[model samples]
Target: MLRPALLALFLTGATAPAFAQPPTETVPLLREIKQWVIGCDNLRNCHALSAPSGVDEEDYSSLTLHLWHQAGPQGYLRLRFDHRGEDVDLSTLLLDGKPLGLELTQDLHIELDDQGGDPEVQSFGGIEDAAARRWLQRLRNGQRLQLPGDEAAHVSLSGLSASLLLMDAVQGRLDNVTALSRPGKGAASEVAPRAPAPVLRKFTAAAPLTAEEQAGLVAAALQAVKPEEGEPEATVGALTAQQAMTVTRYDCAAYNCEFDVSSRERQAPYKETPMDLQPLPLEDAALQGSVGYDEASGTLSYFYKQRGIGDCGGGASWVFDGKRFQLSEFHRMPRCTGVGYGDWPALWTTVPAP
Candidate 1:
């Protein structure tokens, strides 16, 4: 009962992005899947980058391909390499055994700067439209890229396709450019960029709940208690309170579980609805787990199993200013091959910017 109720709350309470606190020195990340990291700034300039995977910690140096675009569709591509030892600046790269000379400042405006001591940073940009398209194709098709040396190091090209699609989503152009570049390759846009952090809205309400109000809150959550399609038996838990909120958890069957949420006092619980998580821009939105609230900071958070995919899903947090909830944080990992993937807790945090 609690699971279904909470499921309904996530579905019903899901709303559009709102204005929140100011951003930090670095733009907050929207997602990190395998090697890719996607995010943007207040200026609406979006970025997508990727690095190698499957390497040990000692051998886990950093080699990333970063792509960015502004609100006007003006874009650039950058490749950055950072290691613990002396800085390594690469002028050319060999991908899948094909040696290609990189025209630094000419073809791509290059930036070689010192980031503290070790871990030198070299970035390439100022790419023309033609070159950007070409590079994207090469990276996707090629298996690996290595610096020319007697002891050359290699970086994996895994997840390059998904990273490019994320770039496309951030830029608001869904022409399937990544797929179109490579004929006969068929894969839908793997992941979508999340809505921007919403601005917080304030409201006036009672300081705490009366006994009758608490009963009504429990009643609101009970509405979502129903058997899922495959599971005939359901186990609803007792209502509990934490901070200034109340919660009820339930186990439907198998991997199906949920939690419901309500403010301690009079605010209505998120409505109940049936819809799968993931597949954003949902005709209907739903969450898969318990809703958590931090009274001191006015934050609401939850994690959910992505629709159709059991291995990975998304997590999000909102700032509740008493009136309405606004987006504060979001994360999505499309594939998690790690041990115990199903119980992976959504671990995103929200620290108000100074």
Candidate 2:
């Protein structure tokens, strides 16, 4: 059974756009290219980021570059940089210790934002397609991409050409003028079209569960996981003294309270099988995470943390229809490169069904 606090933590409404129905080819691809990591979602939207040489280093010292591109022929490329550490003149970026002579303000039309009230941590974005391609072309043959001034931070260009080549192939941009790695006179029309995001219908008319109904479902879920006769009960807040001693070995306050109940499974009352309790089905069979249900919105959610740092994880949510729980959203981030949870790529997405 979920504690009131735990229920409140997990059952809160998700403001992110709710999506539904898994795409026929929703499996995303992730690859590591020598200090750089790249991933593409089902929609063919691709993201590549530079990782620290020391994988365990949490602070992204001077600058981290991220590249994003949409899947279709009309899709454009964009570049972003997150800067930390000491102040440096980003306008004078260097490739192989030589200045590229590119005008950052005019070419990229960059925008800067100070994140988390940290004056030292600034983010820059909005690199134009033409300028981005020019920069990529110049950097691909270089060994290091360095920021000018004291504390000259740099990212290795090793495997960059291969990474861009793979992106070109994945988006079917090879031999086309739009190809970032291998451009030719071929027209953009030859590139593959972007795949449509899957749609899921939410039963908005479904009535909210009453207090009695919620309590009954919770009881049923607890009973489902109850131990056999003479065995120790695994139920929360009702543990025996010995069981509590074993369970208290880990400090929930220091780490995360969600870890205590994340491994436990819960059942919901399915209208089709009112006589029996049924576990809600997830689009991905591997997501064995903490489960939560909202009585108000009739949404069931599962969240799995790759580690206690919360830097990497995946989550999915479903809105309950009259008959069953319909998948509304699914997202995952395979790399723990200091990116936030909201920044994860979406494998399955949906809009409310009309």
Who wins the lDDT comparison?
2
Query: For candidate 1, lDDT tens digit of each residue in 1-354?
Result: 012332222223112232121122233335555655555533334555454344455334344455544322222333333232244555556777777565432355554433332223344444655676666766787777666662334556666676655545443435423321222222223212233333345423324555565566566655555534432222221112321454556664454466655443244443333321223221224345545655556556666654333434666666654444556545554433221221132223233433
lDDT (Cα, tens digit) per residue for candidate 2, span 26-78: 23666778777776765666777776545545324356677776666667787
lDDT of all predictions: 0.44, 0.55
Model 2 compared with the native: what TM-score?
0.69
Q: Which ranges in model 2 have alpha carbons more than 4 Å from their true place?
A: 1-27, 56-62, 84-88, 102-106, 109-121, 148-153, 226-290, 295-298
In terms of TM-score, the best-performing candidate is 2
